[model samples]
Target: MKQSTLSEVKSAVTPRATLLVIGVVALQLLFVVSYVGALHEPKLRDVAFGVVAPQASVEQTMQRLDELPGSPLDPRALPDEETARRQIGNRDIDGALVVRPDGTTDTLLVASGGGRTLSLALDSLTGDVLEAQGRTARMVDVAPASPRDFNGLSSFYLVVGLCVGAYLCASILAISAGARPANPARAATRLGTMVLVALAGGLGGAVIVGPVLGALPGSVWALWGMGALLIFAVGAATLAFQGLFGVIGIGLAILLIVIAGNPSAGGAFPAPMLPPFWEAIGPALPPGAGTWAARSISYFHGNAMASSLLVLSAWAVAGVVITMLAAVLRQRRAADAGSSAAEAGATEPPA
Candidate 1:
C-alpha cells in the first residue's frame, strides 16, 4: 500500500511539475534576452532639441544642428530663448541652444535629470555648432537630478518593486484558493484583497523611496496613488491570467511583467534612446507607462499623469471582467456535473 501511494503521488506530480520547470526555464531565457537586447547599446539618436537665436543666426544654427554627423540631434528653431527654456521644462524637448544677440557667446540649456546621454549629446552637438561660428558655448543644467537618483533610475526600481509584489501576491492568491474560483463572489473577494494589497504596497514604496531612501522627491500622496494603481493593475492582470490558464498563469505573468515589460520600459534609456521596437511599444505597456508617469510626477509637472492612469484602469477592468466570467463558467460546469451524477445514481440499480 505504501509503495502504491508513493507511485500515485509521483504520477500526480510528474506532468505538471515537468511543465512548470519548463515554463521557468523559458521565462529565465526570455528575461536574459529582453534585458540584454534592450540595454546592450545605449546611444542617443534623433533626440528632440531646440535652437534659439536672432533671425540672422537662426538659419545657420538650425543647419549646423541638422547637419551634425550620425544624426544624433533633431534640432528645430525656437522663436526665442524663453520659449526654449519653457519647452525643455515641459519635456517638449530635451535641451535647447540659445544664441546671444551679439553672436559672440551662446548658452545651452539642458535637463540633466532627464538623461545624462541626452545632456551630453546636446553639449557635444552645441559645441560643434558654436565652434563653427567662432563663438563659445556654456552649459546650464536647468533641471538637475537629485544626487540620490542615480542615472534617474530610482523611479524604475521602485515601480518594478511594486509590479513584482503585485504579481507575486496574485500568484499567492491563486494558490490559496482555486485558480478558477467557483463564482463571481469569490472573484470579487479576490479583487478586494488585491486592492488592499495595492494600498499597502503603494504607501510602503512611496515612504521607502522618499523619506527612508531619499531616492525620489515627490509628493508622497501622488506617488502613493501611482504605486497603488500600478500594483493593482499588475495583480489584477495576473489573477485574470491564472483564472483563464491555470498553473501556467504564473509563468505568463512573469513573461509579461518581467521579460517583456522591463527592457521596453525606458528605465535605462528614454524613449528616443531605445530601438525602434522598444520605443514604439514602451508607452503603450504598463511598465513603460508606469515609468513615464512616475518620472513625470517626480520631476515634471504631472503633465502625463492622466493618460497613465487611464492605461492602468484599462488593465484593471479587463482583468476583473475576465476573471469573473471564467469563474462563473467554471461553477456552472461543476454544477451541471453534480446534477447529472445525482440523477444517474438515483436511476441506477444498487451495486
Candidate 2:
C-alpha cells in the first residue's frame, strides 16, 4: 500500500483541526451546564405584583405582602383596579390585589398562565393576608391558561419540538452532502425537502397538542400555521449556518437554541418574571416568540399573534437567502476549478 501523502498528514495534524475538536468539546460541556443550571431548582423569588385599594388599605396590603416569610412577593401599589388588571394582562405583574371598598373581602387577580407557581404563591400569601386582616379573599384568574393547557407549559413543548426538528434536519442535510451544498440545484432540492418536512411537522404538532395530548387549546389552524413557520425558520437558519460555517453550524445552533434560547425563553419563568438580560432576549428568539404567540392565540384572542409570526417569517426568509447564496458561491468555485483543470490538461506535455 502507498504511504500517506504529506498533504494528507498535514491536514490531519493541523492546528485548525485540533482547534475544531477542542471547540466542539467545550460546547458539549457547556450544553450540559446550561441545561442543568437553568432547570435544576426551578424556584421563584421576588415575583412582581400590584396592590389596588383605597389609600388607607393600600399601605396595609403592601406591608402584609412585604412581611411574607420568604420574600416571595415584590408588591407595588397601583392607583386603581383597572390599572392593576391591565398590568397583569400585559404581563407587567404576575398578580394583583383589589381591596373591596367595604373592606370585608379582597379580590386577588392572578394570571395562572404566566406562571402557575407564581399564582399559587400569591394565593397562599393572599390567604394569609386575609386571615390576618379578618377579611376574606376571592381568587380570580385574569389571564388564565387555556382549559386544555396545564402548567402553561404546552407552548414551550411545542416550540421545543420545532427547534429540535430544525437542528436535526439541518445536521442530517449537512452530513448527507457537504456542509455546504455542492450546487444551486442541490441547495434548492434540500430546501424543497425541508419545506415538506416543516409542513408535516407542523400538522403533527397541532394534532398531538390539540387532540392526543390535550396540552393546548386554540384555533388548531392558527397553531398549525405557527408551527410550520417556526419549524421552517429554525431549520432554515440551521441550513444557512451549515452552508456558511460547515459542521460547526450544528454547534452554533445548539448554542443559540439550547444554551441561550431555552433559559431566556421564559419556559420556567415568564419573561417579565425573569432577570433583565434573559427577559430582553426572550421575546426576540424563536422559543419566546413562539410561546407568546401560542398563549395569545389560545387565550388572548390572537391580539399579538401577527407580530410574532412576522418575526418567525423574517428569520426563515433570511436563512433561505443566505443558504442559497452560499450554495451559489460553492458552485461557482467548483466550476472555476473544473475549468482550470481542463486548461492544465490541454497544456500538458505528452507522457
Candidate 3:
C-alpha cells in the first residue's frame, strides 16, 4: 500500500503540473496584494479643484491650498462660482471651493456623481481648512449621484460585469474549438463570434443598469456603444491570450483583467483616492478605462472620455493582431510537420 501510494503521488506531481500549481499560488498572492494595496487606506492626492474668490483673495486661497501638507489638491482659480460648476459638469474639475469675502461662511461644490468618496474627502478636507481659519463652509453637490447609485458604484459594477461576460464568452469559444484556430479563416470566425457576443452582452448590461434597475441614467445608445467596445476589448484580449498559451491563457486573462484590473479600476475608490501604484495603473487597464467611460456617459455627458476610448481601442486592436499572428504561426508549423512526415514516408523502403 505504501509503495502504491508513492507511485500515485509521483505520477500526479509532474514537473509541468508542479509549475502550474506554483503559478496559481503566485497569482493568488498577487491578487491579495493588489486588493489590499489598493483598498487598505484611501487618501486624497492631486485632485483637480477650483477656487472661486475675489481677485484679492483668490491668489491667497490658491496659495494656501497648494501649500497644504501632501499637496492633496491641485487648486486653480476659477472666474466665478458658475464657471466652477460648469467645469465640474464638464468633468474638468473634481471639486471647487467658493469663498465669501463678506462673511466667514464659504461654499464647497462637489460632484458626487463623479465619486462619492472623493467628494466626501474634499468636503472633509476643505471643511477642516476653513475651520482652522475661523471660517465655515457649506457643502453643495453640483452633480449629485442618483439615489440608487451607492457611492457611484453602479457604473463600476456594470463595467466589471461586461468584462466578466466578455472573457468568459471568449474562453468558451476557444475551448469549444481548438485553443489555436486551424487557420486564418477560423480565427476570423472566432473573432466574429466574439463581436456578436460582446454586442449582446453590452446592450444587455446597459439596459439592466439604466432602465431595468434605475441604478444609472444615461443615453441607452451611448451606453450600449461603450459597453460593446468594452466587451470586445476584453473578449478579444482573452482570445489572444488563449491563442498564445492554450488553457493557461485563461488564467492569464483572469489575472490581467480581474486580479490586477479590478482593484486598480477606481470602482470602489476614485483614482486620486487610491494608493499610488493602483492609481498609476488604473487608467491603462480595461476595467478602469471602462468604468471611467461608463461614468462619463452616465453623469458627465460623455465628456473627457477620449483617452478611455483610445485605450479600449488599443486593446481591441492588439488582441486582433496577436490572435491572427498566432493562427498564422500555427498553420505554418502544422504545414511544416506534414511536409516532414510525407518526405520521411516517401523515403521508406517497401514492406
Best by TM-score: 3
* Backbone collisions counted per model: 0, 0, 0
Model 2 agreement with the true structure over 135-155: per-residue lDDT tens digits: 888999988877667778888
Model 1 lDDT on a 0 to 1 scale:
0.84
Please report the TM-score between candidate 2 and the true structure: 0.80
Shift of residue 341 alpha carbon in model 1, Å: 3.8
Error at 193, model 3, angstroms: 1.1
Q: Model 1, 1-351: lDDT tens per residue? A: 999999999998897798888889888898898888888886667889898878886888788778777777788989988898788878889988888877577898997666666677678867876787688889998777678998888888888899999999999988786666667788888989999999999999999999999888877899999999999999999989988998788889888888888888878788777777777777777788788788777777666578778988898888888888988888888899999999999999988
Q: Give the TM-score of candidate 1.
A: 0.89
Which model is ahead, 1 or 3, in terms of lDDT?
3
Over 4 Å off in model 2, which ranges?
1-21, 40-50, 55-93, 124-136, 146-148, 338-351
- TM-score-wise, the better of 1 and 3 is 3
Lowest lDDT 10-mer window, candidate 2? 36-45
Candidate 3, residue 284: how far the Cα is off, in Å: 1.1
Question: What TM-score, over all chains together, does every model reach?
Answer: 0.89, 0.80, 0.96
Candidate 1 stretches greater than 4 Å from native: 1-13, 67-70, 128-136, 340-351
RMSD per model, one decimal:
3.1, 4.5, 1.6
TM-score ranking from best to worst?
A: 3, 1, 2
